[model samples]
Target chain A: MTRKIPQIICALFGMTLFLLYFSQHPTARNLNLTILNDYFQIIFAFTLLVGVVSFVKVNLKAFERGEDRSYHLVSVIGVFIMPLLAIIWGIKGDSPFMWVFENIQVPMQATVFALLAFFVASASFRGFRARSVQATILLAAALIMLLSRSTIGDMIADQIPQIADWIRNYPSMAARRAILIGIGLGSLTTSLRVMVGIERTWLGGDK
Target chain B: MDAGTVIAGILTLAILTFLYRDNPVYKLAESLLIGVSIGYFLVINWSNTIMDLMFVPLFTQGKLMLIIPLILGLLMFGRFNRKTTVLSRIPIAVLIGSGAGVAIPAMLDARTLQQMSATVTPILAPDGLPNISELVVMAGVITTLIYFYFSREHRGWWGKSATMGTYFLMIFFGTTFAYTVMSRMSTFIGRMEFLLSDFLKLTQ
Candidate 1:
């Protein structure tokens, strides 16, 4: 019952969802919306809760061993503090929760993201070698793109922007489309496999 | 300056310290960021998904149908106990199965069919001089697809086409990297402006 039940449920739900896409009936559409709006989200939220529980358990367990106690404490405190603030002041615009989100959360997030620029620049400097025909083509394309973004492209040639735009629209775009096609086919195959129970790995690996 | 701006500026500068090297200050900020973001998301999920969707509907409106999801969601906690670990697989299976089912048709329609349709443009434009850009894109698409085909050993004419495909792939990778760098640089520049103009008042 334990193993078979999950597979049964998976196949049933998968088939039902796939059929709903084809059915033009009103009930079909409503059922689809309900599943999307309630079922998936509720289950996902529970998964998140499970994750939070695991996080706390692991962190507290580690704290007992005196490993990175301070960092763990900060993380746990952060977990509690937001909810506590929400309960106290509510999630309103003038609330301390919003204040923390705007000032502390957002600024920190932006700074961290922005820091990637330097890292990427440093990485390209080391990796963007022109040792072969392929490497040279890649380098030239990258240089064109980067230079077009700045004044250097215009100074070197007036049509740099147009050239970059053409490359972006044609060669770059065609490759992306091919990748998408591959993903589409792959997803379809994987979905069919799961539907037919061939892909039982999700059931904790056919144990 | 407001207290918010001052506090934000300090945190931003503290994080920027990492560019110099890892330091105690950066570590503290990093820890706080990690913790706070998790807490924030937890609160959001609790409020939006649990309380509003499940609890409110089931309790206030008395929608007994919601019990199914509630039960499924509760199953996720089964993973915590070794004896009940297999039970957690129930909800996971439902989630993945339904998601994959929905994605099958969606992926075919949007990713495969639409893209293929777009690529199948007329080779000759209205000017009738054999539109160069369209031909290049068509060629690029065909060669790139050939490059990705792994079932057949690339040899003879196939090898040549696959090699040509690599050039297009390189162009794609290069532009992608360039755009990513530019986006990051834009964000960095924005942060600097915030620090100078809004917080420090160093720039007018």
Candidate 2:
């Protein structure tokens, strides 16, 4: 009974929202918008709490086991400190919370992403060898695109930029659209499966 | 000079130290980053979303309907308790159902129908000449779709078209990779600029 009730609730809500999209009736539209704006928004906020609990639980367990205890301690301290600062001092532009965010979080995130530059350079040098016809085409396209971004491209030939632009606008766009359509169709199928109870992985039990 | 700039410079250098090898400094910075980001998001959601939208509306405005969602939200925490784990499924189900429901029509309209319509264009230009670029786009789209059609075995013209589709796909992937590299380089440049200009005051 416990499992069945949740499955039934899922189908009801899913079908309602799906149908709501096609309905033009004022009452249905209002109900749909209300559920989305009010209910879903609140639910999603609470879901973040679940995520925080899980994160803290995992890190606490690691700390208890004395595995990387110092790092874990730093993490726990930062987590508690930021929220306390924000709540007490308010997250204004000059507040300590914003200060930590701007100085610590922003730089760390940017540096982590910056590390990808070295990794990408190394990977491309190893991977972009012209071993086959497909690889040759990829290598040529990559070289053209990279050169077109530099001042030397125009000095070599003005047509290099034009050719790069044509490749992006025509072939790359077509391939991207095809992938998008595939994803859209796949999502539609999966959503339908869930609504009809064919997909029950979300139930998360032996059943 | 300023504490914030010095702290940022130190953290950035610590993270960059990973390029040499992993060390405790990098690990500490990474952990702090994760923890602080989560806390930042949690506080933002609590104040902006929960306090403003949910709690205030329910109490101040006397909206009884919100109680239902509030109950569902609280019920989500039941996952923490073994006996009440099944109760948590109720909220999870609603979340998944509503999410999927909302995404379906929206994805269809934006990703499928709009994209398909955009692909349809005149093969001839306004000057009554053959538009080569338009023709290329049309061919690319059709061949790419054919390449992905797995129900039928590739043979004859279908095989040739699929091969052409693959060449286009390779070009697309190559362009994507090049652009990604450019973006990463720009990010690296930003950090270098911060260190040189902001931290050291070496450049104006």
Reference-based lDDT, each prediction = 0.90, 0.90
Q: Write the per-residue lDDT of candidate 1 for residues A1-207, one digit (tens) a residue.
A: 787888888899999999998989999999998997789999999998888888888878988899988878887887789889999999888999988889999999999999999999999988788888788888888889988999988999999999999999999998898889889989999999998889888888535
Cα lDDT of model 2 by residue, A25-75, tens digit: 999999999999988989999999899988898899999999999899888
For this target, which candidate reaches the highest lDDT against the unseen true structure?
A: 1
